[model samples]
Target: MTANLHLIPLLPLLGAAFSLLFGKRLGKNVVTLVTCGAVAAAALVTLQMTFILHHDLPPGGALVDTFFEAPWMKAGDLNLSAGLWFDALTAVMCCVVTVIGFLIHVYASAYMEHDENYTRFFAYLNLFMGAMLILVLGDSMPVTFVGWEGVGLCSYLLIGFWFDKDANATAGRKAFVVNRIGDFGFLLAMFLIFYHTGTLKYSELASHIDGLHNILWLGLPVACFAGLLVLVGATGKSAQIPLYVWLPDAMAGPTPVSALIHAATMVTAGVYVTSRLHVVYEAYPQALAWIAGIGALTALFAATIGFAQRDLKKVLAYSTISQLGFMFVAVGSYVNGSSNYASGVFHLMTHAFFKAGLFLGAGSVMHAMENEGDIMKMGGLRKHLPHTHATFLIYCLAIAGIFPLAGFWSKDAILGGAFAAQWDVKNAGPVAAWFAMHAGKIIYGVMLTAAGCTAFYMFRLYYLVFHGKFRGTHEQEHHLHESPARMTVVLWCLAIGTILSGFLGVPESILPESLHHFGDLLGEWLKPVVGVQLHEESAGQFLGFAFVATAVSVAGIGSAYIFFLKDDGVRAKNFVATFPRLYRVVFNKYYVDEFYNAVVVRPLRGLSRILWKFFDEIIIDKLFVGGTAAIVNGFGKSVKYLQNGDAQRYVVGVLVGMALILRVSTHYSAAHAAQFHVDQDGHAVTAVPQNDAYTTNVRFKVEWGDGQESDADSAHPRGLKHQYASSGTYKIRLETTDSRWQTTASRSETVVVR
Candidate 1:
């Protein structure tokens, strides 16, 4: 069964290829069947793997099956191969991705029925699922990156599915580019891991973390830098503070895409990575602190912005960011010398259920209202779309962290983890421990406040969309109808998940004494992989945190009811009027996007324009390209005078050359006569002087074009002979010099050396 793990991701990849190749000819129904059926089959395989891991594998054991391996790349001592890994972690992720992915696919079939490019949409969706599965199940970071980049490409395609619209296309590009920033961080981390550990395999890397810490680059530990870089990548993928701007804009994509990618799978990749490499992160406490701090801040920041969003999906988008921040907090918080890795993954699982449900419900609402997305323009929708309203209400409660729902259990666990996180003042010196304790308290407070804001905003959206009188035009009201049964059925199934998935990770304090060990089931299941014992808090402490969480959620919901349900928007108007400046800031998303444009984007664009104008246009084009052309033209004009094609001119040039050679030869023979004496036979004779006080040795050498050189010698003062190794044009030179070597002259002529 473990050997069949490859099928989990391969099935969807094959489906995507088949749909892309034959979708148009196969027609919509066939394409839908292939797409949905493929994901469903993958989901079934994942379920079987999950059962095998739970029943067959021993406690604290993993089944690693190398399905197949091909050498991917080798650098020095490091080798990477493409393969699959199956364990508790992979099993959980596989189930979530394929199961929810199948639901989204089924929902999209009905939602996108009228679109002409329906097959194309399904193809992209299938590709996204396949890539997401690869990302989850990859045995090495490099293999994970293949899926990472694949999902990024599929995200770009799906986000801008309607490329005809400029806004949609721009949104897609923004998501792609912003994610690239994080991908670069991921790449750097992988390089550093390989550099320090000499391996990229997850198992090997984990084993080598201790060895990595002993190695240092510059003044800091290598593991610290690698952990930080991985966090940067995670931030971009998970939609943390700085890189989160792309997600709200990603709402321009089709609703099913929003549900699948933004709400469920892709955004959680960072949490998965953080949990996957817990050993490395545990060694660097400061890096984990940064992760926790950034996550806490983003949760509060996005929750505040969610308070002011009018668009339905935009609110959910910010909510997704906020929820992701909570998950990060869970993963990063090191309470009592251990991080709550399972709590983070548990929240990731539960957030998928409720957040995806909310998005799909919003899609149903939009479908009913003729594609109107503004919740402000929608009201009293419960009468027209009862199924969507019911599912939406449950999801809204789940997100608000109402008791016993998925969000309540997961979110409270995160908050509990934050509360449990404390500094060991006894071990640490006073000053550092003081700061740690105070920072933990501050983080706890901020997360609590963010949780309140989350509940408030979600209920505000709910009341505005489903409770009040119809606010749209009469024509929209007349056209309002429930979504198809297929869409509603997905909503109901997800709502059920929202209601029940909480039990999988029930807090021990809430359970009876006999069942206490059974609580935190997910934590126990994941203990083999994460290698951390779940810390048990006092029952009183658990009840206390649960009470605070429940109170805040109720307060948030009650406040929304008072503002929107009781009064017809008067309280909300009054509140906004009272705090216009603050409201404006929240409404504008703290102008973070604007600030990024003015500070980052505009400057980059300006620099690019300057480079294009001066460097590209003037320097490259005019100086190099245009200069070369001008030089060529000038040489061509100058050489035109020599192309007269006259035989008389050619004879005159030959006669002038012969005259010059005869003059030079006569001069050379006369100058060297003092050193040469002629015998009676009139042969040239050279004399050597024994008393050489007044003589100087002058040497001359000639190079023939055909790879032969005359040796330097004083034997031939006037000229040196050389042999041509082959037939070619040769340059010949002659030299004349006095005994003192003070006066010398040489000349060269080009001639055929055939």
Candidate 2:
């Protein structure tokens, strides 16, 4: 596993490079063949690994990373490794990604064969798979980000693959920009992790946190901030509130690209990031609570929007957003109460299968209908594409959470996790256990209702698309046909995955304790690396299962059947007229996108305009230009004063200054002479008081009051000049115990000879 881990990411990258570079020369068939083959090979390896893990699990064994490195990204004490891991979680994710991704690739091979940019399309597709694989297999937060940003890049490329269409290009740009909102949060959370634990490597970070007592002012705040930041990233990537508009519009791309990126690979990156960092979230349960609340709101919000959408892809796009919200709520609940990564991730895995199947099925219908995506414009095509219809029906049921299907099992597991999280009364301390006992029922009810909403909209979408009269024109109907065999095959494969993938988290009541094993195996594999216990619901979890599973599936399908399958003509008309406001609100998608444009987008653009004007015209042009002019004017004024020529005035000033200097010099010399002292070396000297004047080794010899000179060794120094070392005129004075000395005669003379 270790030896081949790095190869997994590298293989798809090479395939992408090859297809992009030589796709034109090689042609669509060859390009598709090569890229699909590379991913298929990777899928095969992943399946083999899954089987190995399955066998190991039966024997109560698990797998971990074979090897990793610290890399060179060390700063201060923080250490992060740009390494990869191949534990059970990564292994399962790898299998899901490669297998589903490969199927989509195959489907796109035939679906996109006629398109002009076929090579570029496959290039983006392969790049997305490779990046997604790396995201799952990363051993550290930073490594995960590399994969994260990589997937976003691939999604932007693939979404805009058909650049000829303005809408397609716009959709691609929307996806790229919207996802940036989430990516920003993710990056901030990583910074928080680095700041706190000083390590981003899962193993080291997990090992360092212990006893849970370290969570106080520093630790708790950091944990909360990190969790929230990561949730923001999750919201953006998963298409949660305020950041999800791009997904529905993303249908502008080719259908297979839509299925590949929206369903299986790109959008679900948030769920993966949250689940991967579940351990960090556990330390800040308040943040987890917020995650659940926001997730629930988004789930309902998006679900309502799905009900209103006319476009088949848009409905599924909202559905994807809604379903991802469920996953987030599940993860949040797991973190706060149960620590059940298995359930949340189990839902994530099964979601990829069913949602991918659904999206691909939608694509098949669109292809059969000549690229029309609106359900309102499609109908009665079940007869034309039996394989696509059947596969689509299975996927529809699976997403609706019907029993024995993959979605039912995974969805039930999430509800169960949510139930357990609300009140882990059985194991927690006394105070916490007591609160859980009181609030548990309320929390459980909310999650269960969310599940019901999930079923309703999904069925609504199914009814509109697959179970109706042909609403398209005669010419459009003439083009209706089954998807090519290659495309149908991919649909069937995904249908099977959607139907069977739930066994990974099957409820324990149906299986023996020994066989009730999947969650524990996966939990054990992730626990050491994540530092959070993965919990299974304690008891009465089956009641939650039965209630939610039964209510949502029955209510959702019965409504759909009544409205679309039976007497829909009268019922829909009556229902719409009776509740026009409700219908209109839902139909208009609650005006959320419109409101966002009016409030957020419009304001932001206005602010941007203002900033541009202020910076370009006001600051840059005016302040700088005006300041330079002022400086130049000041220089002109200052230079005027220097231009005056007055040599006679300068000479008169010099003569007056000389007279003042002579008077001050004589007074200072008299004051200093009072403390004069003589040395034995025939030189005149003076001893100045420490505070008043100065003391020196050599003293100035000066002429006495009557122009008489004193010899060395005298009681007081007489002359200022002690010796004629060189010829120069020197000022001389004498003093004997007086505050001021007066000169009897003043003479200016030059000492000519030594």
CA shift of 142, model 2, Å: 1.5
Q: Mind giving the per-residue lDDT tens digits that candidate 1 earns over 267-319?
A: 99999998888878766666788888889988887787777688999999989
lDDT of 2 by residue, 516-571 (tens): 66544444545543444434554465665666577867886776666555775455
Cα-based lDDT at residue 523, candidate 2: 49
Q: Which runs in model 1 stand beyond 4 Å of their true positions? A: 67-76, 168-170, 423-431, 533-535, 575-754
lDDT for position 65 in model 2? 48
Identify the runs in model 2 with alpha carbons over 4 angstroms from their true place.
49-71, 74-80, 164-177, 210-220, 335-338, 423-440, 512-544, 575-754
Q: How accurate is candidate 2 locally (lDDT)?
A: 0.67
- CA lDDT of 386 in candidate 2? 92
* Model 1 TM: 0.76
